[model samples]
Target: MIKRQAREEDETHTAVQGCLRDLGKSLGYDVWIAANDRNRPLDGGKLGDGCLGELPAAVGQAPGADAVRLIDVLWLAKETGRIVAAFEVEHTTSIYSGIVRMLDLALGPEAHALEGMFLVAPDGREGEVKAQLARPAFSRIADLKVHYLPYGELKANREAIARFGEGMKPIQAIARNLV
Candidate 1:
């Protein structure tokens, strides 16, 4: 049962990534999915920081706040020449409050680096999550975007899934979608 659940999680994660890639393509951006467990040497091996130790304090502070860190998907908006829009996907039935806290940390810095920050959830709870983000504390943060894509949307988009699952080459799939 444990292994089966793990496999399900893997499938879910991959589907989320595929949806993201499709969305990025539709928006004319390049998408790169970060490795699930391999953190860059910098940022103390944090998943999002690409440079070794040069990331701002905001990016590194969330771990201590009990936030669950997942692989960060980076998107480069071609029109803006900006890179590193970090996104997180949540499929857990019970919402994790720490995720909002972590977004506060990650977005502060990522907003400056990329076009915007996005939180993708498939459980139909995006409005509530966006409301939480709209609080004054998180409002001042620039270029933050919230979107919710139902699992049905993903399943309906067979071309995108095939492109994403063709291999481990998600980046290539994203590039193809752009063209």
Candidate 2:
């Protein structure tokens, strides 16, 4: 039972990541999947291979390059290669680690404001997410503005989005602002 549950969680997480990757691509952004997840297939190819061959110069040179590289997904502007948004899917992993990844990018050497930074998780995890965000360790960085995007919301709206959505506005609308 435990193994089955674990497999289910992994599948859910991969599905969400794939949806986000497709959305990012459709919206004219360069998409990147986590380095470790590069082997997972999406859009008829390895997710990482479909992404920017090289990260934007800023992210690559950041002090927390390693952390940034592991971010669940990154959507970069095609023309300038600047990160337009970052997302960390906390399907069943530690939320704290996800937030740390966001912090790595936010406070890194080439620090630049991202239009959106999100924690994508199952809907029931909202309370867990809020409680973790309120922890003392995150107190100083409370202004980071990490939003919460529930799995239910994404799964429910993904098809409509892929068919008719234009840009990041559709996603920003569905994601609840954590602050």
Which one is best on lDDT?
Answer: 2
List pairs with backbone clashes in candidate 2. none
Give the per-residue lDDT of model 1 (tens digit) for 37-148.
Answer: 3342332443333322222344434343223234345455544434555556666533344346436545444446543344556646656665665666655433344344
Cα lDDT for residue 114, model 2?
73
lDDT of each: 0.47, 0.83
The runs of at least 3 residues in candidate 1 whose Cα sits more than 4 Å from the true structure, single-residue gaps closed, are 22-27, 37-71, 78-81, 93-116, 124-145, 154-179
- Cα deviation of 13, candidate 1, in Å: 1.2
Mark the 10 consecutive residues where model 2 has the least summed lDDT. Answer: 106-115
Please write out the lDDT profile of model 2 over residues 1-179, one tens digit for every residue: 99999988887787788889988988888998888887876657776666776687777876898899898998888887777789999998889888888898887754474788899999999998888888899974568778899999998998788788876788888999775
- TM-score of structure candidate 2: 0.91
